[model samples]
Target: MKAVETAPHEYMANYVYSNSGLGAWFGAARLVDATGSKRGSFRLNGETWRVTLSYQESGLAPPEGGETPDGTRVDFDTLREFRLNAVVDDEIGERKVKALIQPRWYGLESESGKSVARPMWELGDAVNVRVNASNVEFDTVETAIQRAAGAVTLDPMYFDDRNEEYSVVMDAARYVRLDRDVSGPVHAREGPIARMGHLLESDRSGYRKIVQDDTERVGYYHTVTLGPKRVRECFPDHRIPKEFKHYYARNAESLPDDHPLAHPKVEASYQGSRWDETLRPVDHDELADELEEAVLATINEAGLPTQPLDDDGLGGGRTYVEDAYFEAKTVDRSRVLPLNLERVESDQRNVVVRQLANGLSPVEWDSLKTLVADGGDVSPAEIADEHDWHPDSVRRGLRRIEDMVVREQGSVALRSHYVAEQVVEALDAAREGVRNAMGTAANAVQNAERRSLDERTDELIAFCQSNGIHIDEREAQLRVRMGNLTGESWSELVTRLKRFWTAAGRDPERLKESVTHYRDEAGPKIRQARGAWTGGQTLQ
Candidate 1:
């Protein structure tokens, strides 16, 4: 065999390991020197190595596949010439070597005219694996590294003035990638893979290291013995989002069949119970409901990055959020309350109490009590009318009972008018306590709010009075300010706005009800704008 091709530097020591659990991982394998000053290190991702070399009694021995016969004294010169090319630090036989690397260790080059080092372990230490970092903190930097993933071409539209264009050294492997919420003057540590350690062929000009004598021999021997390997490695990193690892194997029907994420080939292999259930198709109507729910949840969750959508936060990224008709739909997940109150009383063994509400007279109370005792039941509406209490209050009181039962699954249920009445009484007590607290709280809150309101109103009124707003400046000067309200504040804002319109000689009510360019759709439009205003973007 050709000497250089089959040239092997047998390891002075051996490391043996095996996995009984059906798996073993070889992260990175490189034969490097002891002190890490020189190297013969080679990247061996998963490959095995075979080396044959002999320590000659001679001044210098070529590094190749040749076994040693114990006839020669360990010629330290020829012996130490074989360097480890596939290692990080210098090792003596089996001693561990410390390895420290920065992010830029991958981009170093050899100095020109540097002879290809045949020195063993010493050479591995001499190998250059430098990564030039332009200050990791982005200080004095208006422009920083950028990595654009999935883009076929670059666009400089976002840049304005002085330094506009961004350059990437393709040979240096300097690249930019997009990160979530990245915009405007970003700091260092913003770029992908901020720092790393390095090891290169000896001739390559790169980082230098201090090499001790003993380390030199050991490093040289190691490099000549083992080889090199290229493999992926874990590193200390800036925080990365879970979405970066979207393996996409959920029953998230939110992703359409045509979407890449939904394609069968794209999903990560998952064999959970949910996966088994996902295959069983529901009836058409049931499937429709499920699909609708999935869509609503997908859309709702898209606007909220904080709360996870499901166990797998891999479903999707955020989108603008807006909804038109927000009707309060009743969701009775459990049928806790039967239609009649008789079951409640019956269920409670008739110990359940009864009470009259809605202005029931003494006569009516007696009659209603007798009726309930005789196994009769009445709707909340009926009791409200009988007691002259507003049906709404009756309903609300009844709802408290309903809520308790529903919330606790019978941990506590209002079984009768007596039970419902007790619940209402407790609620009233709490409400009264709150009211008492409000009496004290009211002054402080009112004073603070008044001060704030005065300032805001003064600012708005002064600006409007100073400017030609709401009324003609040449005519009567006017100032408009909002007042404390007994009704909806938003509706009051409209009312005040109407007064402004009237002062300006326009129809007040019509203007308040106007569905013009920026009036009717303003609320939803503003909400949409707020949703879309990601980092560095604003409403304007």
Candidate 2:
């Protein structure tokens, strides 16, 4: 089934329709006779042919022995079928499958000499072409192609000398598949296809938009889609001016008499299916070569400037983070500090340092704090023993910010006095914030002890509601009655509440009522919870 060519070569050679996009659907229904249709009849060269549409479905194969002639496989779970039939007689009611059609792109050749002047013909209108035959014989294909080529041409969409709005899809001798992880510039400013940026980019594929000029209200827009095996360029929402349209269009009457379309041509000549990897070159070196030739020929015939991708498949400039990382791995490591710390603005530098500080484990932070306080180089073993941590834990913590620290022999020290000052300042501020928070919580717990049970219950309920932690009135009352607020510090109480909330799948982080922000909201609630916890009532 996979090997069968679904449609006859004669039908393809004789037909003057596209094998992809809207043309595929139209061609299948009409000349190829692959799709069913409303009962109708059309006359071509004195032969009246009746048309009908029928549909079928199959699993993992073509329906009723049908196959995809383009050599692409159907999806694993399903296959589609659309068959065309010709009604022979009304009285006898006999019908026959006219021919099977599998839409295979045959490039820009025509068995018939004619080309569609107005490509946007309505489906009903398109079926009423002046030429047709009992079968797709050479003379029949030629008549249809010639008559259509000789027919009236379409007016341009815009009444302007500049034909900026022309769209075409052409097959190229080469394919483009971008590798995102290969480092380099993803786009270039100067090229035939200029100012290109990717709408979507990934390791294996990308969709890039090329805007030729920014100032023009209406400018040429082009896109190149890259896949593992195929690269297709599309210029949509456009049309060539009448003077130049003849070259790209199927019609060849205006060309020199010796031109292929002007004389004899095979529709599938020099054509290879984009879907069939074996038929066409899988990878075009870059958008700069044959791929560019196809595009440049289409748009002032078009082109792009591209660089070789790096090992990662990401193109363009290396991110500063990656720069610092690569530098850090070197023996000299001279550029690592400036790349990370000196190049960015003050605020950004602080952000980078703060992120580094935040990434350290609590033990790491403690070790750093101790070192900062000591104001000297410290051994990992010494720091670990002071904090009752394993030596490896201390070393690991220091390594998280190793770029900012100098490790020589067995001792680790901040890389510079300035970096030491910054680390100390950041660490001190974080500790102060925590201390202030704990103080507020401790004060709230003390204050709750003075309030009546009813007053405390009201405060707890209001705090929960305001903070987005939902609790019913009954549950609040039960919590106040059951809980005791003795012995636990503010941090311990907050921990207990967070644990229960986490267990219940509620995020404590979303709570707006922080100890510092909602001074009155948390203290009493903490007290009520503590008392209720002792009384064995769960805080809902």
Candidate 3:
């Protein structure tokens, strides 16, 4: 299969979703020590896990029709006592943390000469709307009882949003974070295509709101920080801080389209495009195997694609034949992105030229200008000789120039494909004959007259037992290393050989004959089985 290309970055859920927080899962946790009135911020991965509980005092029971996605039976009374687990920390900047719910569409390519818009969505409607929440809290003053051993990760981000789609509270509570620790079980619906962040706590005390400023303070949206790539504040918090949203408040009138990121792109025409599609150059040894004498010899008539070559004509031709060649198209890797590199290098060179001017070094400029003219390939030694500068210093400048040039010239691979499969088969008979000869040499214990086999066997036993060994265990070890050796009674032969060595030796000549007998008996059978592995090649 051709390699799968990565989806665009916008489709990726960067690690740090908002407020430098690794988003948490809802309705997914277990208190290590469950006890009534035992409540505190359940720390997840050394970070605080926030739990939100709100209830109407007069409510005696949960409202009818209130059901968790998992069908977890609950009512208004149940919601009164809620527990949400969310990572909490100091989130500062122009806006509060929450998901920016913008309806997005992919594959909106233009055909003919017209344009089209894709679907849109409101954040948190289907998704957990967990809308970034404040860090976890404890109703009762107490420290976290159990230190979460591993990560407190959610089933993929969109999992909850997919669940409880048909439920009514989804719309009413479109922007509420779940108190999942107390939520119990929740089911996920797979049909919807949407995503949202939990509503995190606001700087203002008491009730918190979602951040949704599109224009002003958009830059304040959280950046994603994951892994070593330094994922920091990645997702845009839907909640907008009052002061920061002021910049774009007036501009919000022409939203969705007027949002800087939603600009219309005029795609260039693709008159006629061809790309390099070859996987890689083929191998040589694979082309060396012969097959006609092995499989075709059994054919008395034509095969499926056509009549098979007759047995009489099987072994007459050259070992192998391959005549077909392919036509491939490729991009000019050098020039396709030339301007990208040039612009980057120009910025760096301009800086170097300024440095030369600041020092008022006429000689330096002459040497540097000449080296620059040589492009990125110019050598450091050449620059040093031309500028009368030290080699080490010139080397550093050359490295900087090379880096600037490469950064300027972005590198991208040309994708391409080619098609073809050839017939390949090996003669197994030949392989077995070789194995038989090796086995015979190994069985000739009496041939070694100078040192007794029992002497060596004793030494082997001593070596293994010296390090704590049992007889059965040592025999099992020897059997494992036998790998792919051929013999109808190979296992029996090994047992007998070990036994004979433990006592007296056996005849060397008879051992040789046993080897010959094995090859003659199994060689042809092994050869016939080769096609069983590759499946007989059907010439079509």
Candidate 4:
């Protein structure tokens, strides 16, 4: 029988080809300076960077018994995997490195389930294949390593660019801001995500520090890592055939009749992305859904990068993966939202409180109250145990109020001291039967004010038009609002606008929306001053 390979790629592509935009991820093993010695330097992208060496000895024995025809011993008792990691910092930047890279070898197959030892010559061939498949200069990196380390065989190391984490380096220049509807542009802070600090009894290893380092400004990329063992424990209802583990282990043999992949429909789905197969045929959807759930559950799980790093944001380089989608020619850059850290303002906090009061169920309110009263750092399990509620129920309640909370080290807390105060105030008001009334009244007042502004803006536009001056509505509103905010006399503001149109080489007789665009392009400080048009009722 011909050796058959499993079509995991087809299933895997479903994840990569989904509707979601590619987020940055650090997918490589955390840089462990295992050897604690820096190798010689090399240049990359026209910058000099130092390389470090590390070797991890895998306890798992190498494939045994198979040997070359010449009778050299094939199996080794232990396998030592070497690693080379490199980093170069941004210019004059305090810490966050501009590029963190692990050299990759091209000519080697994945070391997934090889049952036999590879020939000794393949390592040299692999090195010759190039690091990152770049030009001759990069290839010299191998020669430099050979000269420094002396007779080291390069293992087939592969780095997937799509797995890199995006750390938005904070500096004086690229400060983040949010353009507001009412107040103006406000500065923001990026906080890291909380992660489980300890190991799970069932897991082998973990990356706790990396998970906790992920922040709103930093994208934490994750891929599906759940395999057969954990999947069976969590999702016993699904039809994950017992033979699934060994499916990839065997290269060419046809799957057993009882295996899910052995089914005709499952095989057909493998041929293309359009999986026409029904769920009942192989329970694929059920398995996929359960696997996805398990993946999410692993966010702070042990054996993954879920621990908080204690390095004070200075030491170490992160794994970076640039997504394959970014390389495509047809990407719509316009639709991409700028990824920036944003500060939640008092108004925003008020809005969230109002939304929560109006939207939360009684149980959600209870959860919020409990969180506030518990010193704001309790675990979800403790909250569930406190109320004797099912964990899912507790989670559902908390999810409804998640906007006002920040999670850290496997515990939850109100987002800030302000949020805590707001929660307490809201809770007190609720007891008095007026919790929602204040929020509602406030919203109503704001709406009325906006409506009044709209009416005045229309009157101002008409007033200007009658005076033989032409302007777009937005432009007119901005100018009037600018005048009001600045306390500029109405006449001086009008003269400035007329001059703006004249300077732009546009006649007042031919009004264009371009004036509004011009006003927006005037930059943040100018735009901030123009949100609400107010002042003299009569054209001055």
Candidate 5:
């Protein structure tokens, strides 16, 4: 038997008209022509009955084929069949039904421009009676129910005979259900699939929407077959069984394009994607070991010096790899061999020498030397402008050179006659003086100690008065340093005072040690004078 496709509307129309009332029983009876047997026997309601079916030609051609315009010839035919069968099942009892079968037709045109008819019996519908009877009319509700029941009994056979048509309807229903259950949730989760749906809805071509709809329909069919639970299990909130995680991941990957879950957008959002990234097993220790081995091999090949291990065969607390890594990072390339600055080129040597001699930073000396080399007799302002230095800084550097000249040449009046060589020598002398001053200041601060608050205050007053230093700034500095000093000897304070005078460009070396001695020893004499004024009793 052949199977055919039948639209639901057409199938229903045929079922209602051919299988209504007594027509349903006759609909299953096979019609006989003169060339075949005219009678057949079938069991109905557990009773045997004989029936005859005959086709009466109406002598009419099916509506005259429209005139084949342009000499186009088309042939068409519709064929129908009826069969009766009985079903004996222990559960439902015996039942008999007649089935009405019809072939669905499609038109074909031959290469010769002649129209051909192709009859598809597989693309057809079968309607069956519901009751077990030879001849019965379904007029009342009870009888109609009985007839429907008999028809259902015959469905399995009918479906087997018309499997293609049955499959078509079943597949469509399955798709609709899948779209509602599976695709809906998937589309909600997956951005890309949702976008695709929107695109389909907005598409003007109609063709694209049709294609997308078909794809979705097919996807739904496959999803149904795979079972919706497989897809749902892989969702983030679902607790997939440990053994089933891999299975679910595989299923998710294998979903067809019609399924929104299978869409790239949707797949990217699945928990499986994250699981694939992080849950995969890794041998971290093995990788670390391999890396260590590779590094040790490279170090040995390069003949690099490694940190020595102790007699216990351990490199301190670190592994061989760690020590090697440290050595690799900290090894001094410059100290690998001695570097003689004297043997360097004259230009490079000059850069180094100028930096040290002028006490200028490398950047500052480079800028200054570049300017002087380019323009002889550069002004302090011009040097400051060229080097982005403050005018005061440039002037101070010039004054230091002048001071150096006075100190070295033993002539304060010979500053105007200084030559370039003398200027360089002066800068060097100034640099040495600044270094010595900084060293002395650091020593004084380090050695300074604190005295009792009252003692420090008296000492500050005496020092200010004796030096005639009326500067509030110096007085403030002395007070601050004295308050901070703790247990320092008087000599430390003297050194601090000497530094303070030296910073004022004065020679403090000539100050008598009697100055501090007078302050320290005068404490007793002053107290005695106060006691005498208070009438000899020791004043508090």
Candidate 6:
């Protein structure tokens, strides 16, 4: 059968052409009815001509054996094809053109099972093709198709939402290289899908969902490009909120048991128990209310402010109790004393008695009390003499009593100051007593010396009479010498008197001479006695 070609432009509109510089088509169309329609005339170099085209059988079939030939019509069983013939009359002789026109390309198939034609470009080799005015080298037609179909063009402003007025041109090749699934509807509005697309191109992990206008189907979502396998680790199932457990449980059931989202192992006993004996559920609100009530009760018992204190409240907004703080005062007669008066008196007496007993002997104690009672008029010396104690010991005992009184009474006793004053007065009186005793002792020593001297004088007088030395002046001279030799022995007194008499010319010879010279002037018997005493002769 022959079909005449008429509207070539109309026929070419229904098929997709390649950029291989080879005339071809890749899609199905009814071209037999389009051949006879008047569309336009062909013009070459300003020469006009009516173009007449027709087709005839080419009588070629696809190979049936080991390998198929290139450019073979494999879509049909019989390979019913045609040779296209074109004639154009000009000033030269008539010219004829011939070319084959098969029903379709050998391997191309449309969705409706119609044969299609495509450029016979090198299929398995690498080829450089232009897309968006830029050359892109692809290894195969499949790669080229994927590059064109999977490419997602986006405005740079979509990712940078902060700057609305800014615009940037992005290379589609860069996005295609990321291998993101960009087959969904990319809306220009600033929505999740748009953001997701932007994230995918930027090598980010994200997801998006959309509801069609007529369908209410939910729970469907798509995960967009995650940069790499490592990038998918960032979006793990554990990060999902626990509140979404119900939905996740449903989803998990659909997954394999080994999947991460699958339900974990549960204790069989726990699952079987309807009402657990060991565990009880508590209402948190009731517990909170009970705790609050207990706290308020405690606060009220403590006498503290229960409500929040205002700025002008008592204690200047500080929590405080009523009459809770106080200062302690020293104990005095003005304060109320305990009713046990006897016990108090006994304790005071015990302290004073213990101090007195520990510090003094019985005699010393009695004497000290007497001295205090006597208004300190009794001397320590008198007390020592009566007690057979040393006077210094008596004074020490009295001083001890004064110290004990001060220590036992502290500042409370009326005797404390008096005792201090008495101690000072006692020291003064004791010193005066010591001086008086020293003077009395000196007088007694002087008197004893005078008696000894008087005795020695009598002895000397008797010795002179016994020796027949009857010098009447001898007694007076001995008395004077004895007075000068006070505290000396009687023998020393006598020796000193002898030396005095010898130096005074009272020797035997000197006395006899003196007696003769004064015979007429002196008594004769006195001169004879003196002579006998000096000459070692007995008195007559």
Best by lDDT: 2
Regarding lDDT, does 1 or 2 come out ahead?
A: 2
> Which ten residues in a row are the worst by lDDT in model 4?
169-178
Better of 3 and 6 by lDDT: 6
Alpha carbon lDDT of each predicted model: 0.22, 0.32, 0.22, 0.31, 0.27, 0.27
lDDT of 4 by residue, 1-540 (tens): 111111111121100101111111111122232334335444545655444555454333332253323333324344334444433334422211112222112122234643222343222111111122111121133343333232122221221112212111111010000011110101111111111111101122211121221222222221122223322333344323111110111221254533422211101111111122222212343433332233222321212221112235331232111111111111111121111111122233433434442456766676777787886478778877777777788777776665566555667766554456556666665676654443532333233311012233333333433333333222233222331223443345555565554443334443221222212222322232222243313222
lDDT by residue for model 1 (492-527), tens = 344455554445334444443332111222332111
Per-residue lDDT tens digits for candidate 6, residues 378-424, read 56667777778887776666555442332122111113222322323
- Ranked by TM-score, the better of candidates 1 and 2 is 2
In candidate 6, how many clashes are counted? 4
lDDT of 3 by residue, 1-540 (tens): 111011000000111112111122222222211222122234444445443222222122322354432343333232222122223333322111122111111211122322222243222212222222111121111122112112222223322222222111100000111111211111111100000011112111222222333343332222110111100111121111110010122443355632332221100111011111111102111111101111111110111111112234442222111111100111121111111211222222223222321231333334345433453334556667767888677545434333112211222110000000000000122124423322222222223222112344434333322322222111112211222334324344334444543442323323222211113233321221112233433121
Q: Candidate 3 vs candidate 4: which has greater lDDT?
A: 4
Choose the strongest candidate by TM-score. 4
lDDT of 2 at 451: 12
For candidate 3, the per-residue lDDT at 124 reads 21
Candidate with better lDDT, 1 vs 6:
6
Count clashes in each candidate, considering only residues at least 3 apart in sequence or on different chains: 82, 36, 64, 26, 18, 4
| Model 5 residue 310 CA deviation in Å | 60
lDDT (Cα, tens digit) per residue for candidate 5, span 384-474 = 7777788667666545434221222211211111122223443344446644322222222223331111233234334533442222121
TM-score of each: 0.14, 0.18, 0.16, 0.26, 0.16, 0.14
Candidate 1 residues lying further than 4 Å off, grouped into runs, are 1-293, 296-540
Regarding lDDT, does 1 or 5 come out ahead? 5
Name the 10 consecutive residues with the lowest summed lDDT in model 6.
Answer: 4-13
Cα shift from native, residue 243, model 6 (Å): 91
Residue 443 accuracy (lDDT) in model 1? 24
